[model samples]
Target chain A: MSEFKQADHKLLVIPGPIEFSDPVLLANATPGTAHTSPAFIPVFGESLKLLRKVLESTEESGSQPILIAGSGTLGWDAVGVNLVQRGDEVVVLNTGYFGDSFAECLEIYGAKVNQVKAEVGDIPSDDAIIKALSSKPKVITITHVDTSTGVLSPAAHIASLVKKHSPDTLIVLDAVCSVASEEIKFDEWGLDVVISATQKGLGVPPGLSVVLASKRAVEVSEKLTPQGYYISWKKWIPIMKNYEAGKPSYFATPPVQLVYALNTSLKSITSKPISERVEAHKAASKYVKDELSAIGLDFVPKNRDIAANGMTAVRFPQGLKAPDVLPKLAERDIVVAAGLHKAIVTEYFRIGHMGVTAVDRQRGDLEKVINGIKEVLGKNKD
Target chain B: MSEFKQADHKLLVIPGPIEFSDPVLLANATPGTAHTSPAFIPVFGESLKLLRKVLESTEESGSQPILIAGSGTLGWDAVGVNLVQRGDEVVVLNTGYFGDSFAECLEIYGAKVNQVKAEVGDIPSDDAIIKALSSKPKVITITHVDTSTGVLSPAAHIASLVKKHSPDTLIVLDAVCSVASEEIKFDEWGLDVVISATQKGLGVPPGLSVVLASKRAVEVSEKLTPQGYYISWKKWIPIMKNYEAGKPSYFATPPVQLVYALNTSLKSITSKPISERVEAHKAASKYVKDELSAIGLDFVPKNRDIAANGMTAVRFPQGLKAPDVLPKLAERDIVVAAGLHKAIVTEYFRIGHMGVTAVDRQRGDLEKVINGIKEVLGKNKD
Candidate 1:
C-alpha cells in the first residue's frame, strides 16, 4: 500500500501541516490532469464518498461534504456568508484562537456574534451554552478542538443541549484540529455543520478546506442568498453535486492536484477502520501525555479528559520561554508550535500526534519528539 | 538546476494548472515544514522579494504582494472585501466569464457595479470604458486576460484613461491568466491591484491566491474597516509584513508545502530576466497561433494584439465539436479545455502554452500539443 517513500526531514510535531504520509505527499506531485477528465472525475467522486465514510455518515444520512480550494480558516467564511444572514444572532463558544476567529468571521457577514469564552485551558460549561441559547440565536458555533489550547470540547454533549433548548438554531462545529482524530457523530449528535481541513488529521498536505452539513443545514443554505460569490452555497452546491455524480462541473477551478492528494489520503484512511484510526490517535496522545508527565511538564488543559487527542499543549516550566525550548527542539530535528492564546502567547508549546505520526509507529516520529523534548528540557530546566 | 524528473503523463494545455516542471513538481512533495520555522521564514520572505521582481516593481515602489491559501477566485473576494466599501459604485470592464464573476463578487460586498461588455472574443473599447466612467465609480476592474475567451485587455491604456477621467478610482486587474506571462508595470502604470493565482503563469500549483496592491490602495484599505475576517487586509497586512520581515507571525496557517513549491517556481522564474520570459511566451504564442491559422481554425479573440500570449482560444472547424476534437486530443495523450464563454461554450477550445510549456522548449510539451491537435483536426475536418 505504501508505494512511495516520504522525503527525509525533521519530525513535524506542530499542531498541523503535520507529517504527511508518503502516499499523500507523492499524490500531490501527480502529473497535470484536467479538472473535467474521466480519470479525475472518479478520483473526486470517490473522494466525496470517502469523506462521508470518514465522518461516519452514509448516503441515507442526508449529509453533504464540501471540499474547496482553501485553508481551514476559509471554511469559517463559507459558513458565515452562507448560513448566517445579516443581523442574525450567533452564539460562539470560544475555547481558543479558532473560536475567536470564527466569531470575527461571522460578524463580518453582519451577524451579531456573542462569544461564551472559557478559561485558558477549558471549554465553556454546558450550563453556559444553555444560558447562551436562551437568547434565541440563529446558530451556535463550537470548536471541537481548539488548536491554540489543545482543548477538546464535549461536542456531542453540547450538540444534545442545543437540540433540546434551541430546536430551530443551527449547530456548527469547527473541527479543524479534531476531525479525523476525534469521534464526530454527525447524525447521532444532530450536528448542523462540521468545518475541517485536509492537513490536520486526514494525513494530507495543507490546502483544501472540508465542510460537512446535515440535511437541515443544506435546506437552510438553499434558501439564503449569500453575500460573496466565492462563499455562496448557491454557487458551490451544484458544482459539488455534479462532481459527486461523476460529471465535470465548475463554479471556480478546483485545485486538481490537491484533490488527488486528498483522494490518496482518504483511501489510506478509509482502508483501515475509522474506529482503529481514532484508537491509534488516542493511544499516541496517551503516550505523549505520559512522556510529558514523566518530564514534570504540566499541560495547559486542566484535565486529561478535556485534552485534545490530536495534539497536546503543555506549559513551559518557570524561567524558560518559547525561544529557549523551540530553538533547542529544532536543533534536535523536531518541530512543535508555540502558544497561540492571546493572553499567554509564550507560555506553552503544542505537539501534534495525528495522522501518520501516530498511526505509523514504524516511523518512530513520536519517539524522536519525546527524546528531543527530554533533551531540551533537561538542559534548560530551572 | 533541473535535478528532478517529472513523471510522463498527458500534456495539460488548459488555461491554468499548466504542466509543472521537474523542480516545481518535486518541490511540492516536500516534507512538512512548520509555517513559522526559521528555515521557512526566509523561503517566504524571499518569495515576496521575487514576486516584486516578476511584476517589474521595486520594493521602494510601495507595492505589496499577498500570498493566501485559496484559488484565483478568492483573489476577487480579497479585492472586493478589502478595497470596495459597501454601497460604493464600481465599473467592471467585461471581457468574458471572469469579468462577470468579478462584478458579481463586488456586488456581493454591496457595490453598485456597472459593466461595459464587448462582443464575445473581444474586450471593451476605451470609448465604452470612458462612457461608463461618467458614473464616477469608486473602482474599475479590468481582466488582463480573461481565461474564458483568452482576450487580453489593454490594461495600461485603460488605466491611463481612467486616471485622466476618474483619478480617484482604484484600478484592479484580474491577472489570473496573465501574471508572469504578460507585462504588468505596477508602479509605472499606476495600477492599484493585480489579482492572480499560483497555477497560472507563476507555474506553481492551484492553491495560493496572489494579490498585489499599490500604496494608494493600501491607504484606502486602512481608511475603511471592511467586512469579513478571512479577507480583511487589516488582519492580513500585519501578518504579511511580519512574514516579509522574517518574523513568524500568523493570521492563519498557510499551505506550507504549496509555499515551498511556489518558492522553487519563483526562484526558477526570477533567475532569468522578466523580459526574457515574456519574450519566450510571446514567441511560443506566435508559433501556436500561426500553426492554428494554417489549419484554418479561427480564434475567439478578434485581433492578434488583444489575444493572450498564455493561451489560445480557438473556434472549432465547421463540422467538428468539443467531443470530436477534445477526446481525440486526449486519446493522443494531450488535454485541453473546452470553450468557457457561456454563449459559445460548445463551439471552441483552449490550449495553454504558458510556463514550462512555453519556456522549456526542451520538454517538447508544446510540440506534443501541436502535433496532437493537428492529428485530431486532420482526422475530423470536414
Candidate 2:
C-alpha cells in the first residue's frame, strides 16, 4: 500500500504551481524555524538578494524587498493601496485575464482605470501606451507576461514610453509568470514595481508572493493610504528596512518552508548564468510549438515574438471544447490548463514550460505530452 | 565553509514556529507536487478530514476547509471579508496583541467594533463577553491562546455566552497558538470559525493558514456579497465542492511542497491517540512553569488555569531587558522571544514548548534557559 494510493497521482503541466525540483521540494517539506532566528535571517536575506539578481533590479544595492504571504493577486492590492490614491487616474495595459484582475483591484480602491487592451496573443505596442500616458496618469500598470493568454508584453518598451512621455508616472510590471522564464531587467528597464510568485517560473510551490520595487515605487507609496490593512505597503516597508539591517521582522506570519524552497531554487538559478536558464525555457517552448505545428494545430498568439517562453496557448480543433480535452490528457497523466478568460475558455488550452521543466527528464514528459495529445486526437477523430 | 555562514542552531522556544519532528521537517523539505494532481487531492482531502477529527468537529466533516497562502493572520481577514459588511457591529474580546490585530482587521472592513478588554493574564469572563454582546454584534472574535502573554481564553465559555446572549453573532476563535497544543472541541464548543496555522501547534512550516468554519458561518458568508475577491468565501465554497467531487480548482497557486509537509504532519497528529499529544503539551508546560517557580522567577500569567500549554511567558528580572537575556540563551543554543506588546516588551520573554518540544530532551534546554536567566541577572546586578 506504501501508506498512500496512486489514484491520487497527477502530473501537472499547467501554467503555474509547476513541478518542483527534488531539493526544492525537500526544502519545502523541512520544518520551519522562527522568523527572527539567526538560522532563518541569512536564508531570508539570501533569498531576497538572489531575487534581486533574478529580476535584475536596482533594489539590491538600495531599496528594501518586501515578501508578503499571499498570491501575486495581492500585489495588485498592495500597489493600489500604497500608490494609487482616491481619484488618481491609472493606465492599465491589458493583455489577458490578469490585466483585468489588476484593473478591478485598482478600481476597488477608487482609482479611475484607463485600459489599452492588447490582442489575445499580442502585447500592447509602445505607441498605444505612449498615447494612453498622454493624459498623464499617476501610474502605468503592465503585465510582463500574462499567464492567462500565454503572451509576453513588451515591458521594456512600455517602460521607456512611460519615462519619455510621462516621467512622473510609476511603471508597475507583473512578472509573476515571467521572472524565471524570461529576461527581466528591472533596473535597466526602469520598472518601478516587479511582482512575482513562488509557483510558475520560480519552481517553488505557491503561497508566498514577491514584490520587488524601485526607490520611486517606495517614495510614491508614502504619499498614499487605503482602508485595507492586510495588503498595506506602508506596514511592510519598515520591517523590510529592519531586514536590510540584518534583523527579520514580520507584518504577518510568513510561509517559512516556502521561502526555504525559494532560497534553494534561487541559489540554483545563481549557480550558473541566469540567461542560460531563461534560454532553456525558450528552447523548450520552441520545441513544443514545433510539435504543435506538426500536429496541425495553431497557437493562439499569432506573433511568435510576443509568446512567453514559460507557457503556450493553443486553439484546439473546431467543435471540441478545451475542457473536454483536459480530462482526456489527464487520463494519460498529463495536466494542462483551460484558457482563463471567459471569451476563450472553450477554444484554447494552455501548456506550461517553466522552472526545472526544461531538463532532460522533464523534456521527456513534454515529449509524452506531445505524443499523448496526438494519440488522443487520433482516437477521437471520426 | 557553507555558502551561507550564519546558521540557525538555536531551539525555537517562542509560542510558535516551534521545533518540529525530524520526520515532519524531512517531509516538508521534500520536493513539491502539484496541488491539483490526482495524487495531491486524496492527500489534501484526507488531511482535511483528519483536521476535523483533531478539532473534534463532526459538523465540519463535509463543510469546506480552505487552506490559504499565508499565516494565521490571514484568517481574520478572510472572516472579515467573507462575513462582515459595512455598518455591522462586531464585538472583540481582547486579551493581547493578536486580539487587537483581529479587531483592527474587522474595523477596516467598516465594522463597528466594541472591545471587551481582558486583563493581561486573565481570560474574559462569560459575563463580560455577554455584556459586550449586549449590542447584538454581528460577529464576536476571541483568541483561544494569545501568543503575546501566553494566555488561553475560555473560548468555549465565551462561545456559550455568545449563543445565549446573541445567537446571531458568530463566534470566531483564533486558534493560531492552541489548536494542536490544547484540547478544542470545535462543534461542542459552539465555535463558528476556527483559525489555525501550520507552524505553532500543527508542527508544520509557517505558510498555509488552515481555517475550519461551521455551517452557520458559511451560511452567513454566503449572505455577504464578498467584500473583496481573494479572501472571498463564496469563491472558495463552490471550488471546494468541485474539488471534493474530484475536480480541484485553485484561486491562487498554493505552496505545493508545504502542502506535502502539512499532509505528513496531519497524518502523524491523527494517527496516534489525540489525547496523548495534548497531554504531552500540558506536561511540558507544567514542567516549564514549575522550573520557573523553582528558580524564583515569576510567570507572566499569574493564573495557571488560564495559561496556555503551548508556551510559558516569564517576567524578566529587573536590571535586564528581555533582549539582553536572549543573546545569553542563544549562546547556549536556545532561542526565546522577547516581549512583544508595546506595554510589556522590557519586562517579559516567552518560551515555547509545543510540537516536538513536549518530549523529554526539551527539559534540558529549559534548564539551560533558567540558568542563562540567572547568570544574566547576576552579572547585571553586580
Candidate 3:
C-alpha cells in the first residue's frame, strides 16, 4: 500500500515538481505531530521566520506569513478581494500574463484596473508606471516574474517608483516564481504585500499559498468593506493572531501532510543563507542557457538582462514551432512548457531551473532535450 | 535540504492522528502525480467511488464527495452558509459541544437556530427531533459522533424522522470521526449532507475536509440567496461535475501530497469489505472497554450501542483528575485528549481508537495508557 503504486518512474519535469531532494519528499511522511503541542508551535513559528528570510524582507516588521490551503492562484484572489473595495482605483503594471490575471481578480471585486502595459518580454519603465499612478489609485499591483513568458520585472525598483509617485497606494507583488529564485527585498522595495505557492521555489508539493502582509496592508484590510466571509482578510487576521498566541482556531483545516512537507522545506532554507540558494538557481539557469547557445539556439527575450534566472525562454528556429519540437523532446521523456501569454504562444518554450533543480539531477535530461532538438532541426539545417 | 526533522515523538492518542499503518505513512512520500493525466484521474475517480460505497450510496445517484482544504470545521461552515439563508429556520439536535458549534456557524449567516437540547452524552430521540422540526425548518443538523463526550447520535434514525416529518428540511450529518470507524448509509437513510476529515478515520495526515452532497442538497444550495464565492456549493458543484465527466478543474491547488496519502489510505479501506473494517473498530472498542471494566472504571455514555467506536469516554475513579493522568501518559510517549465540552471537562478523558487501529497497533499503546492511568490512580484505587 505504501509503494508509489501508479506514477513511480514518470518524472515531473514541470517548472514545479522540479527535482526535489529526497529529504523533502520524506518530510511528508514524518509520523504524527501533535497539532497543538508546545513543540509544534515553534515549528509553526519557525516556518514564518524562514518565509520572511526567503522573501528577503529587511525589517522584521512586515506582515507575518499566513498559510492557507489551495494554489498560488488563490493568493491573487486573496490579495485583491481582501483590500480592494468596490470602486477603488487600482493601478496594474501589466508586464505579462499574471499581471493581467491579478487585474482580472481585482475586477471581480469591482475595483477599476488602470493598466500600465509593457511590451511582451520587456520590463515596464519607471516613467510609464509613474504616469499610470497619476490618477491616484488606492493600490498598485505588479508581478515579480511573469512565468507565462519568463519575464522578470524589476519589482524592487518598480516598488520604489510607486513609493515616490503615490505613497498612499499599497504595492502588491506576485512573487509566485521569483521569491526564492530572484532577489526580492520586500522591506527595501517598500512592498505592502507578497504572495507565493509551495510548489515553486519553496520545493514542496502544491497546496499551501503563503501571503505576507505589511502593517499597512493589515490597516487597509480592516477599513475596507467586508468582501464576503471565507476568503476575507478580516476573518483570517484574527485567527492567525490567535494561532501565533498559541490558541489554534482553524478557519479551514490546513492540509496537514502538505504543511508538514513545507515545515521541512522551510527548515532547510533557514539552515543555509537564502542568498546562496538564489545564486544556485542563477547558476543553473546560466548552465541551461549556455548549453542552448552551444547548440545554436537563440533566447526569446531580446534583452537578456530582463530574463528570469529561474527559467529560460528560448524560441525554436524560424521554421520549427513548439508543437513540433515538444513531442520530439517528449520521446526522450523530457517535458518543457509552451509559451503561455496570447502574444508568445506560437513562438517560445520555457525550461525551468528553480527549487530542487540541480545540474546533477537534471543535466542529463536537459542534454537529451538539447540533443533531440538538434537532431530534429539538424535534419533541416541541411 | 528538505529532510524529515524528527517530531517530538508524542503519540497522538487524541481523536485525530490516530495510529496509522506504516504503508499509509509511506504512501504520502510518493512523488508528484499529474493532476490531469489519465493515469491520475482514475485515482481521483476511484477515491470518489469508494467513498460512495463506504457511505452505501447508489453508484448512479446519491451524494458525491467534493474534497477541499482545511478541517471538518470548514465543512460545517460550507453546509450552513450554502443551505441556510437569512430568515431560514434550521433545527439543531444539540447533544454536546459540537452541536452548539454547528448552531453558532448557522447563526453567523442569519439563520434562526431551533435547538433540541439533550444533556451531554445523550442522544436526542426520534420523537424529540420530530417535535422540534414540527415548525417545518429548512434544515436539521446533527453530529454523528460528538468527539467531546464520545457519544454517537442516532443519525440514520434521525434522518429517517426528518424524511417522515419535515420532508422539505435537508438533513446534515457531521461524521468527522465516525465515518470510517462506524456505519453511515447516506443513500439508504436519505441523508442530505455528510462531512468528514482525513485525520480521523480516513487515517491520513490532516488537511482535507470532505463534504458529500445528495441531489437535493445541491438543489437547495443552488437556490440560496447570494451565496458567497469562496464557500459556495454552486462553485464546487460545477468543478465536481467536471471531475465526474473525467476532467477536474483547478478550483484551488489541491494539497497534492495529502491527496496522494488519502488515495492510498482510502484504497486500503475499499480493498476489503467496509463492514469488516467497522467490525474491527467495534472489536477494538469492546476490548478497551473490557479492560477499563477490569480496572474498576465507569464509562460515560449510558449504552454501549450509542458509544462511538472511534473513541471511548470514561470517568476516572472518584478522586483522580485527568490532568494528572494526561501528562503521565505523555511521559510514556502516549497522548490522549481531555474533555472538550464545558459540562464534562473535570470528570472525563477520551481515548481514540480509529484509523489504522488494528489489533497490533492498539494492544501495546492501549495497555500502556491503561497501566499509566492505574499507576496515577493507585492512591485512590479503593
- Top TM-score prediction, candidate number: 1
Q: Best to worst by TM-score, what's the order? A: 1, 2, 3
What digit string (tens of lDDT, one per residue) describes model 1 on residues A1-382? 2322344367889889898877777778876677887878888989988998998887798888888888899889988888988899999999898888888888878889989999999989888889999988999999999988999999988988998999899999999998889988788888888899988999788889899988899999888888777767788888888889999988777788889899999998899889999999999999999988887889999999999999999999898899899988887888899889988888998999999999998989998898888888783353
Of 1 and 2, which scores higher on TM-score?
Answer: 1
Locate the minimum summed-lDDT window of 10 residues in model 1 chain A: A1-10
TM-scores for every candidate against the unseen true structure: 0.97, 0.90, 0.87
Relative to the real complex, the DockQ score for model 2 comes to 0.42
Summed over model 2, clashes come to 22
lDDT of 3 by residue, B1-382 (tens): 1123355656667778666566767766767554544445666666777778778786577476887765677687677657877789989888788888888777766689998888777788777887898999988888888888888887878877888888889888999888888888888888889988888888888777777889889887877743344456765667666666678454445666676678888888888888888888888788788878778888777788789888899887788787778878788777787777787788988888887654345346666666666667673364
Clashing pairs in 1: none
Instruction: Answer with 1 or 2, whichever has the higher lDDT.
Output: 1
Question: How well does model 1 score by local distance difference test?
Answer: 0.87
- Candidate 3 residue lDDT tens string, A91-135: 888878878767876776678999888888887788888898888
* DockQ values of all predictions: 0.60, 0.42, 0.35
Name the candidate that leads on lDDT: 1
Give the per-residue lDDT digits (tens) of candidate 1, residues B188-302: 8898998999998999888888988899999999998776777788988888888899998888778878888899999999989999999999999999999888878899999
Give candidate 2's TM-score.
Answer: 0.90
Judged by DockQ, which candidate is best?
A: 1
Model 3, backbone clash pairs (residues 3+ apart or across chains), number? 8
